[model samples]
Target chain A: MSLPRHVIAPAIAVLAASGALLRRSRRRQRSRNPRPASTREWTRHPVGLVAGREIRQRLRSRSFSISVLITVVAVAAIIVIPSFHHTSALRVRVGVAPGTPSATSALITRDAHALGVVTTITSFPSVSALESALHRSVDLAVLSSQELLTYGGLGASGSSGSNFLTSLSLSLGQASALSAAHLSPSQLQTLQSAHPFRIVALHPPTPRRSVDPLALVGVIVMFMMVNQYAQWILLGVMEEKSSRVVEVLLSGLRPVEMIGGKVSGIGFVALLQGGLTIASALIASYAVGSPLVQTHASWTLAALILWFLLGYVFYSWVFAAVGSMVERIDQAQSLALPFSLPLFAGYIYSIFEASSTTVSTLYRALAYFPPTALFAMPTLVSRGDVGPLGFSVSVAIDLVTTVLVARLAAGIYRRAILHTGSRVRWGDVLRRGR
Target chain B: MPVLDISGLRRRFGDLVALDGLSFTVASGVVTGFLGPNGAGKTTTMRAIFGLVDLDEGDIRVDGHPVDAARRQRFGYMPEERGLYPTMKILDQVEYFGRLHGLSRADARSKGAEWLTRLGLEGREDAKVDELSHGNQQRVQLATALVHDPDILILDEPLSGLDPTGIDDIGAIIVERAREGRAVVFSSHQLDLVENLCDVVTIIDHGRVVAHGTVDELASAGQPRLTVRVEGDREGRWAASLPGVTVSEINGGEVRLVLEDHVDTDLVLSAARAAGRVTEFSLHRRRLSEVFRESLS
Candidate 1:
């Protein structure tokens, strides 16, 4: 960039006069009395010291307390609120009439078991009573050997009542046929216990998938954690720079050590907060009789925490570098936009994919990409859609990317931090590095 | 005495040359006043000494050994722009800096407290830096620099923005550090205060040392000055006809004449007498400010 003459002129004059003064000083025979020094050892673990300070400061800040409290409340509400509504287990009652076959009750019970619902059977005195009891006393009733009744149709054909009716009709017909054939007990037993053919196909149907509701919740939690903690690092670095404390710190510690310590410190606090939130969720679920407590919870939480760490470590360095470039809060916000875009994009896409039954190719592709993998891979893990190999590969990619990002961020941070007068330009810093 | 030698230092900020072949030596047990005009690289040089600025080409050494991180750790620095963590407690902030410089936690805390007390911030150690007045914050800033008990102190504009009491307090601390046999260097625009407080002054203009010597030596190096007042010479035009003497100041009937080395004081007196009956006449050595101006000019 070309500087105006107004700026260039004084600079030239200063340089010229400095050169002149240099000649003047050279002419004089100046004396040099060098100071003797002892080699004193420095703290070998400066990064740890820096990180330790960050941890203490963050813990003491009121914001950390507030954030943890808010997270607990939010996590508890997510686990507990679903148990309050229709999202919980459904209860069905079946009334059996006197004339119905003794096997009818067994069949209905078996059907309900297959559908993963709770059911209770009550024997009524007569068919009229069974009809009368429908809807009022029971959800369904067996009127006779071949007849059954419901107060209303059991939703669509795809619903529980239709399924129960189909299974019952098949069982009763087979019973009637065996009775008419007059088979011996052994023959009848052999016929009744015959196994159905195991259906295998060259081109199998796509596996059924519903969003693992818990995993969806986990993705949201992970997103919140990674985003919030990364921002904490950004704001923390900005505070040091804006307050001008960074210069003093950089004097005692290298820039890399300063930033490394900050990231590590904040990352530790983030994990602690994540653990607290997860614990609160589990406790809240248990207290509220929520089924989420039993549904592959340990593995789900472990995946969530692992991904949160990966996501945080990857993003924290970038935010720290951005923080060092700008001193004002507004400038930090603006400069942070480009980096935050990827975070927001990944979060939004993950939410969509987690909520959807069929994962798109884009979502699958994103699972392997480092930035979005935090969301995508965890979502797949939650739904049991991913294998161990897929998870490991995604994790490895993120780890490698994290290493690369840290080096780049450290470079930028070291270069930009000491330039104080105005916002340091990335181009200028990078150019200077070259 | 410990000595710091900065030789052949050069740094350019794009088109602006911040430091150009800047060199000087500072010895222990004396306050070296680093003087320069705005943009003359005083702060830049101070920063360079602490390795805050990456020199394009040069070396900074202490006792004929190159300064590295381990060496810089023992050097205390107070930048021209005062900075501290505003939300941090005064003592904790100081202790943090001390710990950064390799002090043990217990030592850092104790030394931080001691410095706070010494800087007149005894009761305010628990207060957040932002809660204090500007002068008190500056005190806290200085405490952070001193908590590590560094062997060399580089303070840039330490006296700026201080009240009379603040100035006196900080000035005394600077002198005390020197008396303790530490190599102390501070930069300020207050030449007169520098004259009184500093044992030696290194004057630089445009990133190079124009003068470096004891205050007395630099002050006495200027051509003699004659202050003459004539009874009726209100315009003070008496010395204008003299070939080698230049009137530096004129007020009412008095003029201060800056004489060239060849100028005779007797001729100056005769000119003042020609104008009017002389009311007062005296010759004195140049002030440090005059030497600073003369060297830069």
Candidate 2:
């Protein structure tokens, strides 16, 4: 599938940036100047080593591959299903009484076409026959040149059949009135154009009043991506600790480097899977010509990716720290609750608030909070409820909070990682023991 | 000069003092046996030397320089908790640890293979750690510790769970590393192995150094004893007649005697000769296990 120019251009820029970074690193590696070993150079070796291991392990795991496959299929189905339902033809059947003049049929067809509805007209021998035909074959019937009969239980309020009947009656009545006035064709045209009315509202229309389906998709994808990947990191850390592999790791590397490497490594995997899902959706939408995917495609996608990284970094550390405290998998469930509760709340709140015309006070507050910002800011931006200033403030809040949470989590992880056996309590870890 | 020197190291976990003024020096080209009873702080001392445990009141030096992260990278540590990633391949796991210790990727890979081959894990490089037997996994753990050819090696209870053959194999490896001029300090409860393999032994009890010397030096530190055998003294009834000699054991023609502090060796010899024609006579030193028990008490 072909990517639109907007998608391809950003992807190329990202590739170019990464290539430059790689070149710079290689040049540093090859530099001939004799320099004393710097701290960054020394630490980079172990951190890179650890991150490489994490990336390789997860990327090669069967579960990761299977999950990616399932997610791609699901995303493709989402993109393709809607186009099939909405893009088909809309036609209404109108049965005419057989003895009625052909001019009435002509009027019905003309008005139906003017209103953008396709029509199929059938002539019946009698009014009873026309009424009977409405039940079996026609959507509505024009009986004896005066009355309109609709099929019982077939036409609901705001249905195409009701709309077609209303347009047909108005067209017929207007033609009769014009004939009674003895207006020429040019006079009729002038009269029809003479009294066109314009409507005015006291309040201005809301910007982006229509709900963007892409943003709704973005919110759901972001919530699931962060929640799922954060748990992966948590379970991975606990497994290493429970299996005692962490002891060997800590002996050679500092706690911060190890946890940092793990977070980045798993974060990379999450991004990879997320990118695949998005690409699948884009390609599927392009293939089926779905208008939903084309609406604000570039900005919605970029926002989703940015918020995902921020959210993942914010939560993955908390999970990693908690993982270090628990000695077994069973203890992880309870410990993970407090960390995941806010994420769930934000997800539910965003889903309910994304479509509302007016933003709620709670939503505005949540948009500024780091944990919920991942859900809130993207929705508000997609809905045009947030301006540039608001978006910047939300991002700044998330970044600052991420730094603080990272520091706190690293401290706890370092203190409790080596304390094996029973689950370590937060009180004991914070107090002292190394 | 010693390769690793830990002096007056003090550490406490809450109110319990894990290491109290513990001091020792491990010189290159020798295996230093770190011996202590269960809670005697041998493990803690090893950890402190590697900079794993922060000392509340002491310092550690390597090669006449204060130990830092760079210097600590030159040392390898195997904790009492035997750890290996169960799902990781043996070769990859070993090389990963080697890289963590600051070896280049190519060097780590080659050295990892060499160590694995030396530890008799030659054909199982591709196998996951969980697939191996407990003894084999222990061997792999040692290979991981030694993969980078560390200048100093600290192994805690390195032979605790090893079978007879596994223990012998690892014992040979440890001695071989020492022969290559690497300072090796390992703690084990098997006094016999320590006595046979270590060039010097340090015994700690109650978090302090109680005894530190060669096996011969520690053994000789105890009271002098004599083992005497007389052809005609079946029950050694005549041995008790000695004024300053106390008979500790008598088995048929043999009599073991502990001499008083001021008693001369000639007096014990004369008493044995007087009782009956002396067939055997030798001065005896205590075994390491006996010395360990005495040191703790």
Task: List candidate 2 stretches off by more than 4 Å.
Answer: A1-44, A82-87, A93-110, A113-115, A120-154, A184-186, A203-208, A289-291, B227-258, B264-281
Error of 2 at A106 (Å): 8.1
lDDT tens digits, residues A1-434, model 2? 22233234433544565477457644654362122353237434666777788889999999899988988887788778887777343577888886554478788877777766788888877887877777679877877666777757335667665666677788777766776798888998897778767888889676547667777777877787798899988998898888887877777676776888888888889989998988888888789886657556677677678788889989998899999899777799999998899999999999888777778898999989998988987787676567666676677677668778987898888778778888898887786547
The CAPRI-style docking tier of model 2 reads acceptable
Question: Once model 1 is optimally superposed onto the true structure by TM-score, how far is the C-alpha of residue B191 displaced, in angstroms?
Answer: 0.7
Model 1 lDDT per residue over A173-286, tens place: 666677779899999889878999998899987887766766777888888888898998898888888888887887766676688788888898988898898889878977
**Candidate 1: what's its TM-score on chain B?**
0.93
If scored against the real structure, what TM-score would every candidate get?
A: 0.85, 0.85
lDDT over C-alpha atoms for residue B120 of model 2 = 89
lDDT of 2 by residue, B76-156 (tens): 888888889899999999989988887777888899999999888998999999999988989989988998889999899
Clashing pairs in 2: none
